[model samples]
Each structure stands twice: as C-alpha cells, then as structure tokens.
Target: MARDRARLGGRRAAGLFAAGTAVALALATGGSLSQAGAATQSDAAAQTAVQAPKATHSQIQLLAINDFHGNLEPATGSGGKINDIPAGGAAYLATHLKELRAAAKAKGQDSVTVAAGDLIGASPLLSAAFHDEPTVEALSGMGLEAASVGNHEFDEGWHELLRMQTGGCLPDGDGQNNQNSCPDPKHPFEGAKYKYLSANVFFTNTQKTLFAPYTIKTFKDGKKVAFIGMTLENTPNIVTKSGVEGLTFKNEVATANALVPELKKKGVKSIVVLLHEGGFPADPKAYNSCPGISGPIVDINAGLDPEIDAIISGHTHQAYNCSLPDKAGKPRLVTSASSFGRLVTEVRLSIDNATGDVDRTNTLAQNQIVTQDVVQDPKTAKLIAKYKALVAPIEGKVIGHISTPSVVRTNDDSLESPLGNLIADAQLADPSVVSAGKAPVAAFMNPGGIRADLASNAGAVTFGQAFTVQPFNNFLVSMDMTGAQIKALLEQQFSGVNGPEAAKYKVLQVAGITYTWNPAAAAGSKVVAGSIKIGGQPLVDGTSYRIVTNNFLSDGGDGFPAFTTATNKVFGGLDIDAFANYLSAHDPYTPVATDRITLGS
Candidate 1:
C-alpha cells in the first residue's frame, strides 16, 4: 500500500491538534473502564467516551538561514525578481526572528534559530575590509546558534575561520600585530557569539578536527535535538586549494548516517541534518508554484534516513519548502531559505509518544521573506549603523561613471556585460598587475562574483555603485596557459545534464580576447576552427599566453580545474583596489562590448 504523504497546509495544523485530542481521549477512557467492557463498547460510545490525550511536550520549531555572506546592511537590487522586494538587512532579519519567536511562544512551542554556512567571506567592503570580523560580530548579535561550514568559510584559510569563531585575533597582511582583540585596539572583534559546526572537515597533519562534529540542544520540553553539520564534501575542489590543503571533507550522507547511532545512544530521538549543499532543477528560471520539487533537494531528501526528521539546506541561494518520504515512507521536512538573509525557513516537528520519534505525520515547513515592511530591531540597526560609519570613507568615495544601466542575472547567459568587461579590463590594466612580466594578455571574471548592475544616468558613477558591482576583495592573479588549456577552461561553461547544457559551470567574462563558439559543434570541438585570439592575434596552440583572473578562479572555482594547470602564477594584490585605481586613473570612461564572445550565429 502507498503510504500517505503529509499534507503541508492549514489542514495539517488542524490535524495535529485533533490527533492529539483523539489519542489522549483513547488513553483516558481505556484506563477508566474494565477491560472486557472497554472491548465490548459500541464504536460510537467509545468515540464519545474517549478523552483527548494531553500533549506531554510542546512542539519543536527550528528556524534556519544560510549564505548571509556578511551582508550587515541591506543591499539595493540591480535586477531580477529579488528586486521586487526590498533587499535583506541584518536589522530586518532580527526583527523577523523576534516576531517568529513571539508567535511560536504564543502557541507553547520552543524555537531555536540556526544557519547553514557562508555566513562570512565574500563580504562587502563594510565587513571584508575589516577581515570579515564585523560580519562575525553582527551574526553573534543576531543570535546564530550554529552554522555548517561552506566553501567560502575557508577563503582565508582554516586558521582565519577559527579566529572569527573565537574573538578575532590574527596578524595583519604585513605579519604585524593587528589583533582586533588587543587591549585598547582601534578595531576590536571582541563580540562574536556563535559556534561553527564541522562534522566532516578534519586536519591532515595532526588528524585533529577543526570544530565539533555536531551540537545537541535540549528544549524546554525535555526533548533533546541533535544537529549534524556538513558541507557538500567537495569543499576542496571549489575553494582555493591552499585554503583547504590540510582538511578533508567526508561524504555528507555517510557522515550524517554515522552520527545517528551515537545520537540514539545519547537518548536523543529527534535529529536534524544541516547540510551546506543544495539542489537545482534543470531550469532555474522556470517559475513553479511548488518550487522545491525539482532540485538536488529531491535526491538528498530521498536518500536520507527515516530516523532523520528534518534537513536544513543551503548553497543554491534559492528559497524552497517541501517534504520528501524517507525509507519508511514517512515525510521528512527538507527546506532552504533564500540567500542574503532574504528569507527564513521554519520547521515544526511533533513527537509521537508511542515511538519516541518525531511524528512525521505532523511535520510542517514554510519559508517567510525578511522584508523592511516589518519593524527593525534597534540593536541590530545600531550595529549596521556603526559599521556603515566605519566604512563610510571607503564606501562613499567616487570611483567612476557609467552612461548605461548594466544588469547581472545568473539564469541569463550574458556573463560578459559592459560593466563586467570594464572591471576585468581595469584589473588587467593596473600597473602593479602589468609590472609582472606576463601582464594579463587575457582576463576572465566569474559572473557569480558580479553582484549588481550599474545604473547610468548620463552622469558620474558613484563609489557606492562601483563597490556593489565587485564587492569581494578578491586579488588579481596572473598565470601562463597554453592555447589547449584555455580551450579546456572554456569547455566548463556549458549547462545541461547530457551535453554542453551540463557545463553551465564554465561561463567566463572575458577581457582582451574575442572568441566564437558553436553549440552544434562536437563537445571537444566547440571552439569554431581558428576563432580564438589574443590581442587581435590568433592564439597559437603551442605558445603560452598570460591570463588574469581572481584567485578563486585561478584555484578552480565552479569546477574549472583546467585553471590550476597554469604556470608562473603571480598574485597581483587586491582586485578591488586594482579596479579603484584603474577607475581613478581613467575617469569619465565609456565602455562598449567589443564582441569578445559570440555563440555561433
């Protein structure tokens, strides 16, 4: 027989209370009556005589957020559906959490708020400029219980992450004393309050783990809930190789499953898996009434154990709420709140007395947008204001001007827009970058790094607008690659399950190079014959060429392993500073598409 799926609507709420009442009544009446009489009672009388079961415990509510990336202040959108709502800010998120906690309390429920990694790293100038310590402090104020480690968490290396976890104390870029935790310091990071979870990440040399594998929290109702945190297990492949050289990321499913018996032995029947990986459907742009039905969530949900009552996911930065059946055909709640603190996911679990397990029959999950429509939390607002003041000089300085509006949308294929091209060109032109013997003969920028669009009003481009375009302080790195290696790098850009469609991972924003590719051409032969060139010269297959890109790409982000094959790599300082200097040196600039890339007409 097909097991009944849990209904996730208002009816489910009614069913929960009704079921509790029915069970209570059955237990009450059966205890009061003689065994023979109780068995002989008419069905109608038995129903009436039975009393509702008084809930021995309250419901468990877990509130989760992910991929905040240290966006302390709210950001204005450049384009896309997200622009429809006001961008997320830490203050607004705090207000939303307060309201949710109050609402849950009104119903006699216990609630806890947590996160699924990328909470820091790839941050804006407000936080990144200060080594992301401000973001750590802000999250601490927001009461983040714990977060699964994401790839960006190791952007500056594991030791840096540890500093952010404890009070921030690290050497300056010059290897001098710049400990924010120093007494009477100019910039102190003495206020961090959250814990990081690392179930699978471990050190290679000492075999010592970075953080605790899992954390157990006991609720007011005496129910102990165990949360196991793990990333995609491919952390090393996506992050800079040096950042994770001493760590090993184990399998997510296997890691979480192994913890089950340990948690059970500790008498914790309710388990929640907070994995930092996510799912994406074949078409991310398609609007579906039921959003979570399609992506990686579907496969991960199906593979999870029945004993696991819920899974909180992240990394895709998409919002979804859905329930999938586990091995026992019991509904297991799986959810992911949108990125940048734009939304929060709520999971409600009801425990069954008979089995000492979560009654999957009554699990409820939903995601709510964090909007400015709600009142702001004063403390969170103050922290944002403080950081804004600290970074004001840098954030407000005029950088350059744009004559047209530039847009950045991931689902679209136009990665090399006028604005992205200009930024890449600026990095390649920096004197510090050019001084290197193999100055960037070509450059590539990841579309994902371009956060916003530049709005042109036939006038000056303000510093705020420029920073928004390329916020992360990624350094420019130059490397030497042969023509064949470049072709291999471009092949990673296709998107789909079978062919080039499965290669969406390879899209590049090019500078100083123009090329045409044919989709109809063979996979290995996608670059049309004699189409690629550097500086108007056809790229020689045997000759080496200089390439410029952010450290992330040089180290192979988005599955482009071919980049790591480059020789004579040189780190040319901060890419953002390079861009700023380039803009200052060449103000009043007008950028146009040079037709660097063209899909065969």
Candidate 2:
C-alpha cells in the first residue's frame, strides 16, 4: 500500500481525504474516537503531504500544422512533394489528421489539433475567390481547435480579419470589401469555430489584444494544457503598413513570459507556445528532421521561460523537429510543419495530472508527412467542390497567350527571373497606373511577391494562372527616390538590413534599368560602383527619379528599407489587374531577354 501510495505522486492528497472520511464514519458508528486515533489521523495527514506523488503521468498528443495558405486542392510542382510522394491539399490534410487522431485514441491518449498560423491568407484562387470562407469551414470541419494569427492574416486589414473570426457578410461598397461571403447569398458565411490567440498583437488605442491571448484545454482526468499563440514581432516589417496600422506586436519571449504567471494563477501549468516565427534548416531536403536548425526561433526558444514546455512554429515555411534547451538548460521540443499543409507535427507530451505540469524528460515530437496515399475526406472534398464551382467561371476565362512558355521566376543563373521581369514591366507599362501615379521612370518587383511562374502548357493563360502568380492583390505604388537611395536598395539585396537571408540573394527584378554587381565584394559594397544605368545613361546619385513597385516593397518588405524612405508615394491600380491588362495588350508574349542584372566575378 505504501509503494502504491508513493507511485501515486501528488495524488496522495486524495487518498488522505478518503482516509479522513473513513475515520469520520468509524467515529459516527462508535460515538467517539480515542485520543490515540486522533494522533494517528494527524500523523497520516502529515505523511500524505510528505509523500505527494512525483511519478504519476498522463500523455496528450498535439497534432500541429502551420502556414497552410489555404490550398483547397492538392499543391503542385515542388511545393506538393515530400521526397518522391505528392502531399498536401485540404482533403488529404484532413484525412491524415483524422487518422492521426484515431491512432492516438487507440493508445488511450488525449489529442487536440492545432496550427501555428498563416492558415488563411495568401490562399489559392478557389479559396480566395470567396474570402477564404471554404478554408475556414474546412479547418473547422477538421476539428482545428486553435491557431496563431500569422502576418498574412493581417493582409486584408485587421477589420476584415475580425470579420473572418466573427462570421458575417462583407460590408458592400465600404472600400474594405474584396470578395463576397458565400456562394449562396442566403446562407451567408460562418466564421471560424476555432480560437485565434495573439498574445503579442495589441491595439494602439485600446492596448488590449485583438483576440484571446491563450486557451486552456482540460483532458478527462483534470490534466490541463494551455496554448499561447502569437506571430513574430517583426510582422509589420513583412506585411503592409496599412494592414497593421493600428497594431503593435510585442516580443515573442516577453509576451510568453508575461502570460506564464497568470496561467499558473488559473491552476494551469502545462504550456505550449504556438509561435508563427520559424527557422530555416541547414538541409533543405529534411522535412521531418532538424539538422542544424537556426533562425529567430533559436534565440527566442533559448530565452523562453522554463514553464513553456514546447513550441510549435511556422512562417519560414521549413519543416524541422528539434529539441533545444530553454532558460534552465532543459531540452524543449521545437517543431514546425512545412507550409501548404505538407506535413503535420505530432508532439506527445507526458503530463503529470496530479501536479498539472509537463514531464519534460519524456516529451517526444516528430513531423509526419501528409502524403497523397490517404483517402480524401468527403466533407472537405464537398467543401472544395462548392468553392471550385463558384470560381470556375472566373478562373477559366482566358486572359492572354504566351509564346514559348516563358516568363519564369528564375533565370538560367537563378537571380533575375523572367516572370519577375515580366511582372515589373507590366507594372511599369499600365496606362491607368501611370495616370494614377504619373509615368514612372522605372519599376521593380520583389521575388517573394511572385508566387508562381507563368507556365503556358497550351500557350493559353487564364485569369486563374495570372492570379496564382501574384496572389497578394497588392496595388502599385509610384514614389520618388534619389539615385543614392536606389543604390542603397540594390546594396540591401546582398547584406546588412536583410540579415542571414541576404546570403541567399533575394535579387529584385527590374524594368527600364540595368545594373551589375560583384558577388565576391564585401557586404554593402557588392553593387559595382557606377554600374547602374537607365536608358543608356548612368544613374546620377543626386537625381530624384520616379520609381514604381508593389505596395509590399513600397512599404519596405523583404528587408528593403530604402523603399520605405521613398518620397511622393502614389497608389496605383492592383498589381494583378495591371499584369492582366499588360498580358492582354501584349499577346503572344515571349520571354524577355535576361540581360537586366549582370554579375561580375
């Protein structure tokens, strides 16, 4: 009995309570207890407090995914594959999650499905056509209980994002409207059933979070787990300024640490952080393995409170399962499932039900592939079909034709892609855009903004394909910048402001300009001196020239801070509209020559 009590850990309190009840019953039956009995009872209570169990354990499974980006249909190209097998799509993702949950159930473990974030924004044409209602419905159907709000979640502005969470039709003619609520106008759109936690984001006026900071889930035996979700503090640096105008993002570790005491006060101890920031792995090929993982998550995890048991991360779009040390030098699980529903991270946490704390020594985490081998979930398929039918008419409309299946995002050298060049030219050539922002001398496009290559398999391109290439719906912004600022912008492509990503070379595609750079030069001086020219004239450092770029870059996205310093900014028409108009105006479009950016040494 003593050995059994010792194994019960903190549960000894319950046994003490039962013993007290037995003593009361005996005294009631026999009229009164002896002095010796009272002394024995006191001793027993003392022993119970001293023998509080530290060995009892219960396991809970956290099924996590991140950066879903609303791919209703299966993703294609390299995005869809995990090694040799095709993976990802709402249907396959749902089926895999169901199977994983069932498998956990078979082992008598409690399970919950969660996501780190980027679940809705940057969606495909099918889901984006209806304001991502189908994606929200599909996630709800899959039993997704909670997720963090990603940077893209603020793409359509926080107001529309709030509408996405609250459920309602878009206000007509309010300038905030993009797509309708649902296919059947009578049905209207139902918002997410899951919770969105943002412990970091706060309203500038209210100083309070827009959503719940965290949520606690209690299992059958009173084992509780708290999930704290938030995006990276640098959300404003990546997303548009207007979208995050009235908000401020707090540091990840600071916000998480602040919440720990409050959660402890609420009697919740086991904690998992669903962070929207992630790191790039050393090996791009390892989807479920973390070999030399390094990024913002590394430092954030190192500084986190010891109470934070595990962190499910995303946003870098790389899959990695790693165990890193926390502030106390204890190993903590850090996991991210690559974007587009390609993988699911299965984190099994052993919790002490008696103490409501995680058993750090026994925690295990792994990333599982969401392969196409699984059958599609019927509910998810029907949801996708409904949205597909609604979008088919708009999606199938032929916008224009391509001559040689050109306009690719990457060139032979992989720096200045043909598609990026075409997109930059399109923005530069739009008449309506020119009228809105005045005829710009030059335009540039960020490579990250270009989502897909212009692949014309049948020499005919549709609106769907064009929309796929530039899905952000960013408007062109014409601005004035000094040639010195332009030089600084070019220099940023290689080093300094861009941080580690600079080494990967995020070359900006240009229109109406040519420049040469030395790859072997020191950081910040990689751009060759006096090599920048426009229309065969060398760029004058003191000259103020009109420059055009998408709103994302105009606001200094992707580490290009010089764009934010631009003057006389004027917003033009949407980039997709500009690209479509340019395509129609220039039919049988062949790939542009890749002589724009030159590399010396």
Top-TM-score candidate index: 2
TM-score of each: 0.83, 0.87
Q: How far off is residue 567 in model 2, in Å?
A: 2.8
What would the per-residue lDDT of candidate 2 be over residues 1-601, giving only the tens digit for each residue? 0000000000000112112222333333552323323432445444344322235767688899999988878787988876656778889888988887897898788899999999987788887767777888899999999999999888777887887788987544321223445567767878999999999999986769989999999898887899999999989887877778889999999999999999999888899999999998788666544556778898999999998988999999997765565777666777888889988887778777667788765565567778776788999998888877777877788889999764678655638878888998998897655644368888899888888888665899988888888888787888899999999999888886463453377789899889988877888888888889976799999998888898888878878999989988887777888998889999978887888899874
Pairs that collide in candidate 2 are 9-52, 9-53, 9-54, 10-53, 407-419, 408-419
How close is each model in CA RMSD to the real structure?
10.0, 14.2
lDDT of 1 by residue, 124-198 (tens): 666665667767777787777888888778877776678777765544542121112222266566735767899
Best by lDDT: 2
lDDT of each: 0.67, 0.78
Q: In order, how many clashes per candidate?
A: 19, 6
lDDT of 1 at 408: 35
Q: What 10-residue stretch in candidate 2 is worst by lDDT?
A: 1-10
Residue 498, model 2: Cα distance from true site in angstroms: 1.5
TM-score of 1: 0.83
Task: Work out how many backbone clashes candidate 2 has.
Answer: 6
